[model samples]
Target: MTKLLFIEASPRKENSYSSQVANEFLESYKAANPEDEIERLPLFETELAPLGMEGANQKMENIMKLMTTGSGIEPEGEWAGVMKEIERLKSADKVLLSAPMWNYSIPYRLKHWIDLVVQVGASVMVNEKFEYIGQITDRPLQMILASGSPYENRFPLESDGTKTDFERAYLDHIFRFLGFTDIRLIRVMPTGMPGPQLDEIVANAKKEAKEAAKAF
Candidate 1:
C-alpha cells in the first residue's frame, strides 16, 4: 500500500481552488487504490512554534549527532519535533502539496514547516568536495497551485530578462533539493480574475487534476 501525504497550505479551505482541486485528486486516488493510506496535513491548523535559540541549538546538536554517530541514535529535546516532521516526509511514497499564491510566493506557515523539516544532515549533506546531496527517498512529488494573476499578465516579469514564476520556481527548487526527481505541477491560473475567465481556468484545472490523480 502506498503512503500518500497531502500537505495543504491554503487558509481558504473549500474556497481555495488549489484545495478544491487537491480534494478531487485525493478522492479519485482513494477510489482507484483502496488500500493506499492517505493523510492530510493542513498548515493553517498546525501548531508551529518559533525556532528561537533553544530550537536552533537543539537542531544543531541533532545534526552534529547524526554526522558523528549516524541515524540509529534518536534526536532529543525540541529537535525531536523537527525529526518527527522529517520522518513523515520519509515515510510517504508520494507527496502532494496545495499552495495558493500569496504575494507571488508561498504561505508563511508552509515556509516555516519547510524550515523545520529541511535539516542539514537530515534532508541534505555536503561532501568533501563541497557537493551537496539530498538524503530523502526519490519519489514523485506533485504540486497544485492557484494564482490570482496569470504568468503573462504579470507585466514587468513577462518583459524582464527572465520570466520568474515565484510560486513554481521556489517550490520546484526546494523539492528538487530534497531529492525528488519526478515533480509535477498543476496550476489554476488567473484564479481571482473577474468574469468567466476564472471559472474556465478552474474547470480546466479540475480536469487536469483528475487525470493527474490516476497517474499519481
Candidate 2:
C-alpha cells in the first residue's frame, strides 16, 4: 500500500482554515485510495528536539567520517531524533503539509522540523564540484496553505517593495531542493478577515481540495 505522510503545522486545530480544508482533502483522498496508509504527524504534539551545539557537531562529525572512512557513526540523543524524522520522510511515498502562514512565513515548529530533517548525507548530498544534490526524489508533495491576507497573487512584495509571502515560496524551494518533483499547492486566503462571504470562500476552498485529492 502507498504510504502517505500528513504533516500538520497548525496549532489552531478545529479553528484553523488550513486544517479544515486539509481534513476535507483527506476524506476525499481516503475514498479514492482506501488501501493507502495515512500517517498523521502533528507538529504541535510531536516531540521534535532542537539540534543544539552537540547535535550540530555530531552531524558534521558524521559527515566527515562518512567521506573519509565510508561509514558514519551512529546517532545518539537529539541527533537520533533528527535521524528518525529524516528516515520517516525518506520512507514516505507521498507527503502533505498543512500550514497557516505566520508572519508571512511558516510556523516556528514547522521550520524547526525542516531544520531537523534537511540534513547533509541524509536528505541531501554535495558533489565534488561543490554542487548540492537532493537524495529524495520521485515523490509528490502537496501543501495546503492558509493566509490572513490575499497573498497568493500579490506580486510577492511588501508595501515598501521588500520580498514577502515566504510561505509558499520557501516551502516550494526547500522541498524541491530536497528532490520533490511534483509539488502542488492549495491555498485559502483572507482567513483573518472573516466576512459575510467567508463561508462561501471556505466552501470553495474545500471543494478545490476535494478535487485535488481525487488526482493526488
Candidate 3:
C-alpha cells in the first residue's frame, strides 16, 4: 500500500495557491492510485514548539534516556511530540510539502517543523570523520513551492541576475542531507503580479502538479 505524507504549510485555506496546487496534486494522485492512503498534516493545526537551546538539551537527554532504556517509545515532552510527526513521515512512502514562499524563504512554521524533523541520531547520523549521513532513505519527496515571482520557467533568473530559487535550494540541501535524492519540485510563481499573469501561472502550476502526481 502506498502511503503519502502531505505537509500543508500554508494557512490561507482555499485562497492559497500552494494549497490549491497541492490539492490538485493529491486529487490526481488519488485518482491514479485509488488505494493509496494520504495523510495531511497542516502546520497551522499542529502546534509545533520551537526547539530552543533548552528544548534541544531536553530532547538530547530524552533521546539518550530512551536509548539507554531501550524503550524506543516516545516520551512526554516537546521533542517527543515532534517525534510523533517524524514517525508519520517515517511510515509514509512519499512525502509532499506544499509551502508558500515568505520573504524569499519558507514559512516560519515549515522551518520550525523541519528543525524538529532534523534531529541528530534520529533523521541523521555522524561518522568518525564528523560527516553527517542521512538515516531516512528510499522515500521520494515532492515539493510544491508557490511564490509571487514566477521563476523556474525556461528563464528563472531575474533581469537583474538575482536568484529567486532560494527556498528550493535550501530545501534540496536539507532533503539530500536526509538521504532523499529523488526529489520533485513544481513551482507556482508570479502569483501577486498584476493582469492575467497570475491566472496563467496558476493554470500552469495546476497542470504541472496534475501531471507530476501520476508518477508521484
Candidate 4:
C-alpha cells in the first residue's frame, strides 16, 4: 500500500494558513486514493532534541561503522527516540511538509527535527570520489508554506525584505541533498494582509493545493 507522511510544523493548527491549505490537498488526495495510508507528524507535539556534541559524535561513529567494519561502535548518549523517527522516515513512500515561515526560516522545533533526521550515512554520504550521495528514502516532497508578507522572490538577498522565497531555496537544497528531486511548493503570501487580500490569497492557495494533489 502507498503511504503518505505529512509533517506539520505550524504551532497553530486550524488557525494556520499552511495547515488549512495543506488539509485541502490532503482531503482531495484522500478522495482520490481512499485506500492509501496517510500518517501525520505534528512537530508541536513531538519533543525533538537539539543536536549536541554527543549526538554528533554518535552520528559520526555510526557513519564510520557503516563505511568500515573494523569494530563495533557504541553510541554515547540516549538517541533511541531520534533514531526511531528517522527509521519511520526511511520507510515512508511520500512526504508532505507544511510550515509557516517563522522569522524567514523554519521553526526551531522543525529545524531540530531535521537535524535529527538528516544523519550522515543515513540521509547522505560522501562517496569514494568525494561526491555526495543521498541514502535516505527518496520520494516526492510537497511543501506548503505561509508567510506574513508577500514573497520576495525577485530580490531574496535584499535588506529589509520578506524571506519566503529564500526559505524555499534552503529547504529545496536540503531535501535534494537527501535525493528528493520532485518538489512542489504551495505558498500563501501576505498572510496578515487585510480585507479581500487574505481571501484572494487563500483562494489561490486552494487552487495550488488542488493542482498539487493531482500531480502527486
Question: lDDT per residue, candidate 3, 78-118, as tens digits?
Answer: 66666776677789899999999887778988988888888
Predicted structure 4, TM vs. truth: 0.88
lDDT of 4 by residue, 152-199 (tens): 444256565434355767788888888788888888988877689798
Stretches > 4 Å off in candidate 1: 65-74, 152-164
Q: Any idea what lDDT model 1 has?
A: 0.83
List the candidate 3 regions with Cα displacement exceeding 4 Å.
49-54, 62-74, 152-164
Highest lDDT model number: 2
Clashes of each: 0, 0, 3, 0
TM-score of each: 0.89, 0.94, 0.86, 0.88
Clashing residue pairs in candidate 3 are 148-190, 149-190, 150-190
Q: Model 2, range 93-201, lDDT digits (tens) per residue?
A: 9999999999878999999999998988778887899777899899999899998777654336556244379788889989988988899998888777778678878
lDDT of candidates 1 onward, in order: 0.83, 0.89, 0.82, 0.80
lDDT of 4: 0.80
Better of 2 and 4 by lDDT: 2
Using TM-score as the yardstick, the better of models 1 and 4 is 1
